[model samples]
Each structure stands twice: as C-alpha cells, then as structure tokens.
Target: MGILDGMTPKKLIIWILLAIGIGIVLFILMLYLTLKTKTTSLERITPYKESLKRELVTLRPVHIFELMEPTKSNYTYAMSDTNQYYFQVLESETGADIPLTKLKDSIPAGATIYFEKAVNYTNGVSGSSTPRFFGTISYKEKKYPIEFVWGRYTYKSHPENLRPGFTMDLAPWNNRVDTTIYYLPRGSF
Candidate 1:
C-alpha cells in the first residue's frame, strides 16, 4: 500500500525481473571468486619437488572413498611446502577389492590395483604442487592405470567428510595433470 500504491502491474513485473537478474549476476560473481581463490593460491606457491630427499615409497590401496573438501570446496590447496593428506592402505593384504562392476570397463577383468604413490605427502613430496596419486591394475599379463591418492587415515585424522567408496581426483604427475580418475580402494562397488 505504501510503496506500490500507484505502481501498475507491468511496472511491478519489471522490478521483479530486474531484481532476479541482479541476484543471478551476484551468484555468478561469488562462484567465480571462490574458484579463483583456489587457482591463485596454488599459483603463489611454486612446487618444490626436491624438498624431500628420500626414496619414493610405494603404498598399496588400503581404503577408497571420497577425498575431503573445503567449506567452499575450493581450498584443495592449502598449507606451505606440504599438507597432511589422509588416505589409507592395509598393513597386510586383507583380500579386499572392488568388483569389476564398480570399475566398469576402465579396468580389465581379473585385475588388481597397484598404487603408484605420489611424493606429495609430508616427508613424501614437499611444497604445494597439486598433490597427485594413482596406480596400476594388473589384468591378464599387463598392467592398466587407476587413481589412488596418499593421505592419512580419516579415522585417525578426525577431519572432513571423505565419503567411502570411490572418487575421481586430480592426477597430476609432476606439474602436468594427465587425467582425472577415480581413486578407489580394493573392494566391491
């Protein structure tokens, strides 16, 4: 009654549309800034691959699940020189594995996962360098590729929600990211 007392139906519609337009623009801008933050942050921290002087260790896939995410899911890259990554591998062979159904055609039948440990963990690989992890799958007489990130066990870390099962993560070897593949533990789908 006060503000719209003399406003026509057409005028009211125009105002509503304009408001919606502004809202959409604001939403897009916020999203852009959030993603940009991650990219910028990583750029500032050049990767120091040589920071860690030790033999590259190979770990077996102990567990597979969704990796942790940030509040805005953008700060995948934080910490200086290194980050405390949390993933798991069995101390002994548990006979655990993901059935072929879950692996789809990506992996051949009668294949087993072989972790290609990345040097991106504390005392593993130092500096911020897009932490990467993956491994190989043995089928027939040949070995195929699979993804596996090295990290601390979530139960021990007591940190973010890392869904159990499988997750496609960035597989950056050195500075080049060859592909983004699912990091799955040895088990059924």
Candidate 2:
C-alpha cells in the first residue's frame, strides 16, 4: 500500500520489461552506427592490414663446408659449395684459424663456401629499398657478389670447444639459419 497502492505487480513488471527492451534496442543501434563510421573512415585511406601482406620464408638448412677468416681479423665465416650462403658465426677470441673440425660438420679443404648477407627487393616505382635479405648467408662458390658493407664485419668467427666439439651441436649453424629466416618477414614490409 505504500509503494504500489494503485498499480498491480503485473503492470509494474510489464513497464520494467518495456524499458529494458528499449535500452537493448538503443544499444544495438549505437553499436551499428559506430561500426559503420569506423568502416567508412577506413575505406577512405590505405588499410595497414592489407598493405603488409608479404612475409619471410624460412632459410633451409644446408651444410657449411669451409670457414674463412676475414683479412686481418679473428672473425670466422662458414662456407658451402652448391648453396650460395656464407655466414660469419662468432668473433674469434684469438683471431686465429678456425679449425674445420670445430664446425657442425667437418668443413673439408677446398670445399665450396656460400655466404649471403640479406635478400633485397627494390620498389620499382618509388626506387626505395624494399624489405628483403638485409643480412648475410654465405656459401663458398667459385664466384660471388662480395659487397663490402661499410663499417660492418660480414662474417664472425667463434671459439673452438663450443660445448663439446661437434657431437650434437645442431644449435650453432642451424639455429643461426632459423634466426636469419625469422627476419625475412620484416624485409617485406
């Protein structure tokens, strides 16, 4: 009698239900409008999602044959013959000759070496540097394009006795190949 003297409980419940229904409809309408505006604005310019689609491919694992020490340095570089990928693994502590036995597989003398730094793609229209292999993967072949990047050592040499000499140390060369491939995606963008 104090709060609902004239109105029945059923009538009060009906009014509350109607208010909830109206609120729900308004919320849905607001959501739709917001989505429409967002989509329209996005259509006016280039979409970032669509602009960056190219990705980096993984570097395949190949055997490195011979390791090279850059002139007047202790850094070491790995070599392969069939594949044109040369890689400098780590800085040499003493800057001496890296033994072939220290490598994951024995790099035989006169074995082919391949090393590549990076893959490059140029934008034809803009003449700009497109994302590509900006790093090196080296192999030993008869002839290779050896571009000397200023202020940077293209190869690195590692210490001998890298955790029990070449038994199951797939971590050294294979891991580096994975890392090099990991950067491939950034090259596209």
Question: Could you tell me every candidate's TM-score relative to the true structure?
Answer: 0.29, 0.20
**Across residues 1-189, which tens digit of lDDT does each residue of candidate 1 receive?**
499999999999999999999999999987665444231111112222221222222222222222233222322221111111322122111224632112123222233544423323222122122333344445456443434333222222223645322222222223333232322222111
Please give the TM-score that candidate 1 achieves against the real structure: 0.29
Provide backbone clash counts, one per model: 13, 39
lDDT of 2 by residue, 90-189 (tens): 2232244744313334233332222233323333344232221112333454332222211111222234522211111122223231112111111132
User: Which runs in model 2 stand beyond 4 Å of their true positions?
Assistant: 1-3, 37-189
Q: How does each model score on lDDT?
A: 0.33, 0.31
Q: Candidate 1, residue 44: CA error in Å?
A: 12
Off by over 4 Å in 1: 1-9, 28-130, 135-140, 152-189
Q: Which predicted model would earn the best lDDT?
A: 1
